[model samples]
Target: MNAAEPGQPADHVVLRRAGATDARPAADVWLRSFAAALPTVVSPRSADEVRGYFRDVVVPFRETWVADAGYRDGIVGVMVLADDELSQLYLAPGWRGRGLGDRFVGLAKERSPQGLTLWTFQVNKPAHRFYERHGFVAVEYTDGSGNEEREPDVRYVWRP
Candidate 1:
């Protein structure tokens, strides 16, 4: 996949299969994006908890697609696509609202034309809207937190 040179204005980004070397940047983008979005969605956790969450939940997810703008300053964004699920998609805070997420989700749909599904905290209205704008519809709800009792999450699905 070819991404426009960094700092250059361009259209949608290209998606590429992630490799072992992509893990760290993927982790970084995930951490930064989560941190940026956390306070509005959930109670903020300590730094260690965040790091541990990344290690435990994000790192081991094998299927991933990465987006780059042809610069190595850091990973601009990442999308974790496993099975018919889009587990995660995050761009640096600066990169948010630039249509990258739309592009990423579009690419994932192309790769999995049967469609894809993902879970998101019900309180994340912005995310819900974003997904909805991309053709996803809330199909179910369940405990957002893994704990037996907590606020519920809404499951969203997209069908091509």
Candidate 2:
């Protein structure tokens, strides 16, 4: 049911500003996507914990966007930005590799014209490659300490 399936090209998908109603669905996408992709990098929070975190803390606090999946009941993905940093970006399991991420970054660049920075766990090689392909460069690496997950991470920067 992913909107990215063959006939559904991503270019036509609209990225919209997320609202209060989107909090839970967006969080669900985040949790499911994280569960599918990041198990090797960090221990995931329980589903209830993730739902609470995103619904209460993230969606309400961050400037967030969600890609409309046309006919689908929920969003195709979610992006949350904090100032000049790309705090989070998660696509539904079937939505990856559909160019929606590049589109998301283009939007992020528009929102933060100065530059953008993000942190991703070092073990997430696909994420590292994706950001690099989109012009992000690794600027720093940290041992598992500062982040809640306490997983080693790398900081990436993108300059206009």
Candidate 3:
């Protein structure tokens, strides 16, 4: 069950640990969210590049979660809880701003009491604001690679 606060819509958003069966859909959502959010950074990723990313990076991250809108069919969002860090959290563009992210974070925190930490693209102002609203503080920043073509990333930490 979701560990959302009372009256939070996330309380209704079903959250569960992702298994092998969820790989494809979870990857799909991850790709979609990344593509949608990437244009704000350096450049949009090609389909091949996104697929390769899923194959190389995302799939190997075994700890994943999928959030659904109280349905058994479609997925609304996905999150990766890796150790004490929140490695990835992505909601479908259409399903954003409805407290799904908060619910996902809440569930992750409930399961792992060390609280949550994440890295967000520095250019993603909205995400920065959302994380700040959720009590995350920027603790550090790093270049998007050894190269300077891409935007930097800000590391955020949330202490419960």
Whole-model Cα lDDT of every candidate shown, in order: 0.73, 0.87, 0.73
CA lDDT for candidate 3: 0.73
Tens-digit lDDT string for candidate 2 (45-80): 777888888788887888999987767635888999
Q: After superposition, how far is residue 93 of candidate 2 from its true place, in Å?
A: 1.2
Ranking by lDDT: 2, 3, 1
**Which is the better candidate, 1 or 2, if ranked by lDDT?**
2
Off by over 4 Å in 2: 1-8
Cα lDDT tens digits for candidate 1, 34-134: 76865554445655664465556555655777776556444678888778999878887667777788889888898889989998877778899999999
Q: Write the per-residue lDDT of candidate 3 for residues 109-129, one digit (tens) a residue.
A: 787786788888888889999
Native-to-model Cα distance after best TM-score fit, residue 82 in candidate 2, in Å: 0.4
Q: In candidate 1, which residue ranges exceed 4 Å CA deviation? A: 1-13, 40-61, 145-151
Tell me the number of clashing residue pairs for each predicted model.
0, 0, 0
Best by TM-score: 2
**TM-score of each candidate?**
0.77, 0.91, 0.77
What TM-score would candidate 2 get against the native? 0.91
**Lowest summed lDDT window (length 10), candidate 2:** 1-10
Candidate RMSDs in order = 4.4, 1.8, 5.2
Clashing residue pairs, backbone N/CA/C < 3 A, model 1: none
